[model samples]
Structure formats: structure tokens, C-alpha cells
Target: MGRAPQKVRNRDTNPCIDEGDASLKCLDEHNYDKSCCSAHFQRYKNCRKYWHSVMLQRRGDGVRPDMPTAAERQELLDAIGGKPY
Candidate 1:
């Protein structure tokens, strides 16, 4: 018998992610002046970090909860056959 599909947040449309994207867009519109949009930049960083944690947790592998660094993110992207953005 076929099992029903489980529901999960759609990454592209998640509200938290959308907010992060909006914050990024604003920052870009302002010429990427971090001093001018530090709060928005911080929010985007936090949102992306949380999403990364959630994804690692869902992998069912023993992933640590330590704060991820840029190198770690690059490593993960490489392991997953993706290019670092």
C-alpha cells in the first residue's frame, strides 16, 4: 500500500525565508551598506542559520548544534554536490 505524503514547509515560500529575502533585497537596494541595514542583515543571517539547523536535524545524522561558520556551510554544500553561493 502507498503511504500518504508527509507535509512540510516549502522552503521557497516559507514566511520566515520570505522575510529574509525581503531583508536582503532591501539591503541590496541600499547598495549593501551594512551600517545602514544592520538589523535587516542580522535578521536574514538568523533566518538562514535557523533553516540550516532545521535541515541538518532532519538529515537523521548526528549533526552538532554548534553555530555554523562559512567554512562549514561551504563544506556542507560541497558534500551535497551544490555550489556555495
Candidate 2:
């Protein structure tokens, strides 16, 4: 039997793609040296942490779709007027 096709996700569906990509790009530019990509990695980590908190808050408040849709995420960010982290 053939394996099932893998589903691809992008920044829209996965909010942290840009931060993740920046970290990866840093790694590539630095020839896979971890030290040079520390800031990128930290940024990615912060992004994930911020989103996770939002998800948890939504879940606690009994919001539908615990992970907000892209538009909803954007609205929340706009309302806050800055980065969650």
C-alpha cells in the first residue's frame, strides 16, 4: 500500500512560519553554526510561546477553534497593538 500524502502548512495556517524560516535562513547563512543563529532561534521560541499562550487562553474561555484563524489572530494582534511576547 502507498503511504498517505503529507499535508503542507504555511504561515497562514501556521502562524510562526516566518520566525521559523528566519531561524533556518540564519542557520544556512551561518553554515549550520548554532551560535550565529541564537537570536533567530530565540525569536522563534518567543513566537511559539506567545501563540501557545493565546491558544491556552482561548481554550480556557471556551472559544471555538482554540487556535485562532489567521484573520482572528491578526485582529487580536491589532487589538493588542504589539507583539504578545
Root-mean-square deviation (CA) per prediction? 11.6, 3.0
Q: What's the lDDT for residue 7 in model 2? A: 43
Candidate 1 lowest-lDDT run of ten? 6-15
TM-score of each: 0.42, 0.82
Which parts of model 1 are misplaced by more than 4 Å? 1-17, 28-32, 61-85
Off by over 4 Å in 2: 1-8
Extract clashing residue pairs from model 1.
Answer: none
Put down candidate 2 lDDT per residue, 24-76, tens digits, no spaces: 89999999999999988998899999898888998999997888888888898
> Which tens-of-lDDT digit does each residue in 1-85 have in candidate 1?
7997633344432425455677778878889876787777777677666656655674556555333444665576579786322
Error of 2 at 13 (Å): 4.2
- What is the TM-score (0 to 1) of candidate 2? 0.82
